[model samples]
Target: MAETLRIALAQINPHVGDIRGNAERIRRARAEAARLGADLLVTPEFSIGGYPPEDLVLKPSFNADAAAAIEALAAETADGGPGVVLGGPWVAEGKRHNGLFVLDGGKIIARRAKHELPNYGVFDEKRVFEPGPAPGPVAFRGFRLGLMICEDWWFPTVSETLAESGAEVLISINGSPFEVGKAQLRIDLAVPRVVETGLGFVFLGQVCGQDELVFEGASFVLNPDRSLAVQMPLFEEAITLTEWTRRDGRLVCTPQKLAPIPSAEEQVYRAMMLGLRDYVNKNRFPGVVLGLSGGIDSAISAAVAADALGPDRVRAVMMPSPYTSRESLEDAAACAELLGIRYETIGIGPAMEAFGAMLAPAFGNRAPDITEENIQSRARGLTLMALSNKFGDMVLTTGNKSEMSVGYATLYGDMCGGYSVLKDIYKTLVFRLCRWRNAHVPAGSLGPAGPVMPERVITKPPSAELKPDQTDQDTLPPYEVLDAILEGLVEGERGVEALVAEGHDRATVLRVWRMLDRAEYKRRQAPPGVKIGPRAFGRDRRYPITNGYTNLIA
Candidate 1:
């Protein structure tokens, strides 16, 4: 006789180091599952201590705390309401492993370790965990259920092994972070496994933000025929109960409701919002403050701040100098008013004169150079820092990836801030995102109703406004050419010859390459920001600051 199993997939968010809080979260999910009459409650990978604890897992005390939390959760299962398939760190045979625990009747019945350790972009699992042997299915609710971790399902060996060992259904718990189009990629990767093993596939993932990573919980279930049965929403915590019944010796899940998948623009915007919101809230900051230049980059940064933390929580300061145009001041003021946030204007003329006089004693009467331009930027930076200190607000840097890529930004000047909102975005994308934000305000945004950013801000040429007639194109190549060259070099795909062959001027490409290589030290010192692309600065792309090897041809 065949049976039915109601497995509740909990897509939840867990902090990196909060073991006790994570356990509480697990308990809450279990209680909800009990009410839903679920036979089993499945959670994301590392639900006890959070994912990518980084070096925290190496600490003896942290692992001990994680172990204690798991035991406590196991003891709660005595109520006999719903069995739990939990993921956390486990120490066995004198080595640490990414382990999953199966709890039933007030005790941990079995522990399954992950077989594959991923070592690539954004994943350093091999450094912390020792791989376990290929695992078979664990008996749960009168059925042999194959329990696998995040990376195990990415490959074929683990699923194949479990199928050969008499598993009825495949359930994978994941802490997978959001990339541009990762949801479709996950479905594509799972379809083959489901077709080969003739097993129902359940991918239960976490929904949360951790440092530079944001996990969008678009969990889903697929029938053995490679058809989607259940689909959960992304970028949020959701509890989805899926039904499965054995039919003709093959497990098939009952098709349920499917949440609408977010568009590319929506997903990228939400990732930035969630990442910034968590970074500010988890660290316990009152609010955020930023310099509101009339340029496109600062405009977008201010919009994101207002969206993440409510309008009243954001403060915009317009620091204009003698070189600043009247249109810039008006544009900045309009943006602030439109966003319904606090705004103020302070002239940097006094600070500039003071700095110039103080440095005049050295008899530096030479023609004005880039040093003077840097002084204005430093003055604005000092002013922002002072305001941040007085108000207990974090200062948000407004520079984007295009500027950061080419050493175009001043060190300790525009770069002085607690966090950056557009650090990974390029200049070309900056304009596009501003248009997107104006056309549609995101779901949880606290910004204004109509266009928060003035139309002129998006249409005007971008500039630092440190000197008169200083457009970005005057100092560098056009944004279109620059961004294309950057994507090629940063993605590690095209070299100098390849770029030149792709209809790019050899001189322009080589100049951009040299600037990118020389600016590594500056990016190293810049503040952290949300990552919305395939490769970001911090963890995704790591280059030595003092490297002398140049890929550019003479």
Candidate 2:
């Protein structure tokens, strides 16, 4: 008969570069696991030094501090608590490597390095850490347990090697970031490994927002038969204990409570909220303020800011210029009232006139064109920045992906902000997210209930309101068509002709492709925002601003 083994999974949020602080967190979790009578505790990959430390791993001091923190945790385990399987940076054989530290009996019994270093997409692990050889199972408490870091379990080789080395169960830790529909992909990818090895699999993940990445801790356990035994919640830190018992010469994990995963809309909304909240809080911003233009983009951005940092912390400024309509003013006011945030009506007409007068001398009788329109936008930006400076709040920009892709935004004007809430969100998704928020206020939302967004905002034609009777369609295609074309180009990286062959107009595709190519410089200067898609502008899609590549011309 095999004795029952209790394992505690710690889904914790680790701050990057906070070695001692992360060690403190591990200590607290270890104490809780000991109180729960668990035999072992597992943490996510890069738990101590945080995930994707990037170039920080190059510093000798950072690595030294990380090693010291590991030693501290190992010494603390001397008091007879649960054994810890933690992850951090390790230096071995004159090369820095991402490693898993197996600590028991006041010492690191075994050290396993990450066998696979993912280099595609947002990961650049190959540049920083050296990959270790294929790791075999580590013997622990009368069981041969295989410990696999993130990217290791994604392939069949690691699990096969472990099973061949007499491993009974697989424990995989991850610092997996949240993208749209990423949760399902994790399960889909892990299930095949379980089927191939005929071994129970336990997935432990870290939960928190780091820069543009959000680590959703949807941890789970799958038995050898491919049945889900335990599930941890997403977008939260948790410690779940699962009991494994031997039945009929096979180790079986007992079923535990499962948390309901949020809908696609809810997941994206929460990811934005979490990403914004952490960015503001971690960077020590007093709060956030944005221009409330009563359009869907600004309205939803205001709502997200209110929900992220309570309404009191959010501030809205309505900067109405000469071209600003009465409906926009009414809807902007209504939106502010619904969210219960500080709202101010600052007419940008005065600033616009001042700028017009100042630039009149250089105009040399030239007729008013985009220069005048951009002045209105710059006026609003200047006002928002002034308010941000006075009130000590960060400015939140509210441009959607559709506008961003086609170079429809004013660079130094509307793009002036500390952060962007809807940077990666498409215009179509913006409408959907706004409707979802109105219908269902997310859990832990700080704004008032029942349709925080005014209905008129969504139904109205989207506009910058920089000129009289102007709408986005005056210069761009319908959002439905525009978003689809942009997605095919941006996400799929399809050629202009490919998009045209997909039933889109060749002229429209060529025009959009030209705009997208020309907007690289603007995007390069734009603020960082939450990334919900795989091919977000910054980090993920790195196109040179000076490049002359053009799919349309080709």
TM-score of each: 0.97, 0.97
* Tens digit per residue, CA lDDT, model 2, 1-554: 34798999999988888888788889889988998999899998988898869999999999999998998888777788799999999999899999999888888888999999999988999999999988999877787788999999999989899988888889998988899888878888989999998889999999877887888889999998999998889888889889998665446799977888899999999888888998898788989999999899999999988998999999999998878899999999999999999999989878888888898898989999998998888888888899989989999999988888888999888999988878999999999999999999887687778788789999999889888899999999898999999999999989887888889998888888889999999999899998899999886998998987654622
What is the C-alpha local distance difference test score of candidate 1?
0.89
List candidate 2 segments past 4 Å from native: 247-250
TM-score of 2: 0.97
Q: Write the per-residue lDDT of candidate 1 for residues 27-78, one digit (tens) a residue.
A: 9999999889898999999999999788888998999999898888889889
Candidate 2 accuracy as lDDT: 0.89
What is the C-alpha local distance difference test score of each model?
Answer: 0.89, 0.89
User: Candidate 2, clashing residue pairs?
Assistant: none
